[model samples]
Target: MSEVRTIGILGGGQLGRMLSVAASRLGLRCHIYEPGANPPAAEVAHACTTASYEDEAALRAFARSVDVITYEFENIPTSALDLLEDLRPIRPGREALRVSQDRLTEKSFLRDLGLATAPFADVTDAASMTVALDGIGTPAILKTRRLGYDGKGQARLSTPADAEAARAAMNGAPAILEGFVDFSREISVIAARNADGDVACFDPGENLHDNGILRRTTVPAGIPGPMRMDAVLIASKILNALDYVGVLGVELFVTPGGLVVNEIAPRVHNSGHWTQNGCVVDQFEQHIRAVAGWPLGDGARHADVVMENLIGEDMERVPELARRPDTALHLYGKAETRAGRKMGHANIVTAKSS
Candidate 1:
């Protein structure tokens, strides 16, 4: 394979910004293609193409500028990908996106792999929802199959009678009804794979969420050693199944029965943010290495860390947080701060455990 000197990124969010930073560290340039002006990544990337995905000329130009293409998020329009995929390699591949972009498809894929997930059924309308509720029961979550994140595009059904309101919440989008799973806590494994089929998984991190947005992730998750292994194996399993390259984040629920699959992100994950301060190679760098055809780096944890997300009003605590020792703050260069917006994060190293 030819040497890769440039990477083309699909989205220009914080993940893209961090990926670009990591790429630069490795003597690589990143070109960010985003429709939104003043994206966070524009400040860090070597170049930014401000054009809609529908713009074929911009897409072709952007494709010609980079050696490999990767994305910060799923949900890139298929038409855009069809054009770009013909010009350059898209790491993690389209299958990963096809499997992860829809809730129902993701759940079904997990089940087919002999993995455990919450009982889920498809719901397109009132009729299908009634059947889904009948099987999944009440106290369930009705979520749109596509384009939902950070608690958006979801509604909770406390009881069967609340089905109407929950259905209405879907706004006519195809939905899935998931029966609640009894889990002790949420954890995630940030795993990476390269074209050579080698896989490396970081230590699992325990997560805490507020209003569907991740609030904190603590490394050295207070789980048994074996459970941690289980998380890693699960991540590795998915990585291999997809013939995946680059980094993938797998979220799981530690249930009394076993760890249950939650969802997968095909790029560097938020839960792995602590690695920035706690590991020799962070998720962003690992992803760049994998996609750039470099060997994977050691992701072994060298410290105990607590990563906290700075959302909206949390930005007010930045000055106080900066005063604390052993804390590293990574603020996204977002222009505006609004309710539920993720402004930045802090990784607090509690101890050097390695």
Candidate 2:
């Protein structure tokens, strides 16, 4: 802990950018190791190593340059983890990564822990998908096991007739078929764990998505008073299960029976961005503290915040939102404005949203 002056981050995206900023605030330097050039994180990081994850020589150099390593996203190449971890510690650990990398494995882990989740089946081909649908029933979602995010690599099945389309979506990749859950709202709990085994969880925030991309996250999720405690407890159970150290985002479906686990993100999540303006310590800083072996900070909220993402062309609205009261804008600094890409976000703070 005392020797942690530099941190190495995998993937140089917006999450990495925020992490780098947080590390700087703590007087720690960040070194980004990403394959892409001019990554957002590289703008704020002290150094950047643009190289492929498969390049062991490059990974070895990155490992030697930093005291500890962490990642911005979950789809990291296992070979990189195997190589870098031998030189430095990777926080949140490999177990968390392994479980969250695949939808089937993640669901199984949750179910095994006695947590509630949607009925699911593994899909490898057209025949397998057909078999999975028979048991999971119609109105299901077919999603790839890896490298899928923000509505990519997924197709919805309304009935047996939709099987071909669902299978086609996989395009030969391994997939999972999940039964749908009729829920009132979707909420995510961002929790953190330190090396000392101390855990701190943020309040649940309700989410709204458009075409699989998160559009907004509203705090005080309107969860029934009693359900709030249960939500936090459920997220804590997952953190302890993996012996996880660093922040984990647990996405849950609010149902009448109880909360149904939807997915788990192994790093700082988009939904947790509201914490930037609402909480004493945001998810980004909490993650940095945990991985750096520092004490976690208070995650309590001082104001109700609604975080709205600027997807693609939404950047046009920034000029207007900038003049709005109590709004904090955080842009990703991406050069291209591809449709559905998260270019930035604006957090609207107040007593609460009506």
TM-score against native, each model: 0.98, 0.97
- The lDDT for every candidate, in the order shown, is 0.94, 0.92
RMSD in angstroms, all models?
1.0, 1.4
lDDT agreement of model 2 with the native: 0.92
Candidate 1 per-residue lDDT, tens place, 116-200, comes to: 9999999998899999999999899999999998889999999999999999988899999999999999999999999999999
Q: Please provide, for model 2 over 79-169, each residue's C-alpha lDDT reduced to its tens digit, 9 standing for 90 to 100.
A: 8899887899999899999999999899999999999999999999878877898898999999998898999999998998999988887
List runs of model 2 lying over 4 Å from the truth. 352-354
Best by lDDT: 1
lDDT of model 2 at residue 66?
94
